[model samples]
Target: MATVCISGALVDKLRACAEAGFDGVEVFEPDLVSAPESPEEIRALAARLGLTLDLYQPMRDVEGVDDAEFARVLRRAEAKFRLMRRLGVDVVLCCSNVATATIDDDEVSARQLRALGDLAAEHGIRIAFEALAWGRYIDDYRRAWRVVELAAHPAVGVCLDSFHILSRGHDPAGIREIPGERIFFVQLADAPRMELDVLSWSRHHRLFPGEGSFDLVGFVGHVLHAGYAGPLSLEVFNDTFRQTDPARTAAQARRSLRHLEDAVARADPSLTGLEMLPDSAAPSGFDFVEIIAEDTSTIEHLLARAGFTSRGRHRTKPVTLWSAGRARVVLNEQHARGRTPYLAAIGFEVDDASAMSRRVAALRTPRAYRRTYDAEEELEAAVAPGGTEVFWAQAADEGEPAWVSEFEHGGPRIASPVTGIDHVSLTEPWQVIDESALFYTATFGLRTVSATDVPGPQGLVQSRVLAGPDEVVRLPLNVAPPILAERGGPAALSAHVAFSCADVRALARAAHLRGLDILPIPANYYEDLAARVDLDDDVLAELRELNLVYDRTDAGEYLHVYTATIGNVFFEFVERRGDYAGFGAGNAPVRLNAQSASSAARESGGFGRVRA
Candidate 1:
């Protein structure tokens, strides 16, 4: 097991951090740093709260300059060390000097590092030498570690950062070999892989752990195996999390932890899953279920032919349904908004939606309000995309109970009607076609469902699907061609269709060899993409060349897949990159062809493959 840290700001933001399974806090420095209380008082608060001080960060620019600057830096280190001593804070995070360094020569820089280490040793503190992304002397850990080893002071250690580690596209094996005792701390943060400068991103937009595109679990495993038993703390400097409520921020923290823990369990059996956290991996959780049609008449005729009966109006959007006991189908119109659901969001049953809503609101995270049918009349349960809904009549409305009662009654099968869709992967691009795919796979545990080549005006793109949480959701991994160059792109693929794959690249290769009109994504996307992805240049190039999309999750698994269309069946071809298991939600279509011949055939009562 690895040590976990609860950031000090998260204490007030998510009072539940410790209760949620965190072992320590980074102290965030500023919490105690600028507080009115004495340093010893903060230590008392930590002891009373059962929280350990994971780290005190950012002794900026300590190395550099002549005798005069050196003296001032030493005095500063001394003051910080005294604060550490008073609070029993054992670890000090000393990032390599980034800005305003007076030294330029290599020899002088080395001398400065040795001096810092010596000062830490005198103050009885262990210094975690981390190279800021823009450090003047030490930038890469491998390069900086040379000075750390040279300092020869046992107090100097390393702080392995997923961002810094991945930003440079370096392998993690070095971390795996470092003595745990010598590795003073591990910093955890994830971000959507971007092409932004390191400093701007770090101070402005780092994401919470498991929320971005980094391979979190594998990163963690590498650290754990390194024998470094330091606290794993989140150092996200996200604008979004800060804008949201503090309580919900805490819940986000908890969920982020659970998502990562569960991802770890799925990716590697050795890692433990969180017990207290609610997960999308919960048994029977439905990702999504689909009933497709080119037009409304087609759907009505199809369901009518199947002898299915229609349920009443949907509480939200334009979703109609046909049902048989324990077996139900939902009909979504083609005209629905956005890429896919201009029609409906999602609905679920809970014993107490209001209570759950209150609990969620108590956390103060953003939430959507919804109304539902109650025991006597209309009742309201605040609803959004995920759980947090209560419907007393959901059992009867859906033709069965929402949850299978294991209370002496839970048995053989509690019908959810049709098993739910794993997840719906809707692939659209803000120019970056892969961003959507990365978001779902990395933040959630969705795996690559499929990847298939499609003809486009611009060329071919082999989009893939990823599925995870092992639920009933269908992610329709879709893809469109690049805006420039090539022939017209292929059209008439469905708005979305979830995919699953045993092998993602092979699937892409299969589609490519199959002559299934493939689209070409730029080769440079891989090189640029490599900055965020942990894979080697070759692997990144191959995935991009195949037009396949992939994202790393907190578990260090690469969820990838290919897109496919089997006649009017419209299915996704999936491949799991590494251990990833998410449906590509980023791949969706602007238009779908339900078989051109079939639409005409249906009008004439000719033979047409019927869909229900």
Candidate 2:
């Protein structure tokens, strides 16, 4: 890991890295300078923590200069080399001259690098020459390698960085051309594709390996194929990561590397030095969704009005089961005394529960603890980055989960139109939204479909959706606008589980008759919809009367309705027609506005409880 990837006192960051199971760390120069400990003391701390001080970086603007400037660069290089000796590090990162290069000739740069390498050799240090993506002249790795070859010094080599190479769209297949010994160090970082200058993007937006859009597995494969055996260190400069807890961030960093290594090993069996993890396949479908609340009456009433029947209580726990068609909800009150109602956990039906459990354990994901009786099935679960528990289960011979037997059926089933879980939407904390995206993708093999901005009352909410194979499991993870998040309270949190059905119009009419507390949509919204959507007069009137939202695409149409927010959780019913795959994102703004208005009215005590 890179020192700049986390925030804390330099010593504390080192401890975090060690605790996260990193064997070594790249000591970014600024962190070392700002640290209070002497270089020798820091070295002692790393020794005690079982951490190797891998590389002391970065000796910047060291090449591509005149003789006089070259002499000055050598003096600075000698100083850092002395510091590295005290820090017990042997490799120094020398970035291509960005600000002080007066000449563009590689020969001059090569000569200067050889001179620097001579100085480094005296101090028993190796100079790892790297190309800066925005360097003045030697900005590409291939050009930097040419210079390293021209230098012809035993102490000088090329350092390959994923961001510098991949961000510039350079083909990594060229990596195999460089001999293994000439490649001294490898620094890896992934980044979201953004429209920005290279310098600003590198400094602010770099994400972990699986969190971004880079083809890191292929990149690492090329490096490994070249026989480069070294620590795969991280060098991220993300704004959010720099402010979070160092320990948590370090653990997250370690997980990313493991995930990437697993990917590389799986993609090509020939790759060495990669640990192969247990195989993970997409979940078959959602088994059940669990909600926890201190006062369950509100949700109980709402679910009843929406046509959910009380299946039964848990045989030996403070939990109850409710179902409508294929949709099942586990209402947990075991640990809900001080908590508001919230979407707590989701259970997925998988082909192999044991393999999935082992895979997650290998990834170092935090386990979610649950108590089960000796006679009950022991379901394995992990906590998501957004604090949602994820459980995996297999179906019994009767085509229902074995755990269903724990809940006794108290009454005859009431047939309802709700089919199954369409999708589950969770509002993530701003810092962990990207982390959550990575977790779902890497841990469960979910594919990110789209990322969009839905305008809310305060600002735009960033929404990214991840879907399983055949689109069976869809998750819309949302990050609220900064202003709304800053106003931290239960009112700011929003999450919902959407159920699918064949006929939303009929369900909405039946729900209205059953006295569902539907969110009120503005009449103007329907009027505007009429101007755009090709809805007939009767359909449009029905939508307006039932407080439903609609969206259309070239292939199909979507109809959905939302229940009023009960604490931080709510319910949504959706109907998809003719292969529609979206979550009706176009109607998010209307829903946000109506929900905000409802929340405000209730806070002022002007809105009575809209209940059956």
Taking the tens digit of each residue's C-alpha lDDT, what string does model 2 give over 144-215?
999999999999999999999999999999999999889999999999999999999999999999999899
Q: How many Å off is the CA of 552 in candidate 2?
A: 1.0
Q: Candidate 2: deviation at residue 517, Å? A: 0.4
Lowest lDDT sum, 10 consecutive residues, model 1, at 403-412
Please give each candidate's TM-score. 0.55, 0.97
1-612 per-residue lDDT for model 1 (tens digits): 011222334335224455544566666566665567777776776667677776777677776577888788889888988888887877788877777676765466667767777777777778888867777767777766666766666777778887788766677677766777877787777776678888777766666665566888788877877776556677777655555445444556654655565556667666443232222321233322345343444444433332335554354545565543333445656454333221133333333444434434333234444433353234333332222222222224344554222112211332121222324434343222333343344333355546666553334545655544443443444554544213222243334333343454554564454344333333454565577767877876677666655666665444443233222333333444454444332332211222333334445876322111
Q: Estimate the lDDT of model 1.
A: 0.52
Top candidate by lDDT? 2
CA lDDT of each prediction against the hidden true structure? 0.52, 0.89
* RMSD in Å for all candidates: 13.3, 1.7
Model 2 Cα shift for residue 452 (angstroms): 0.2
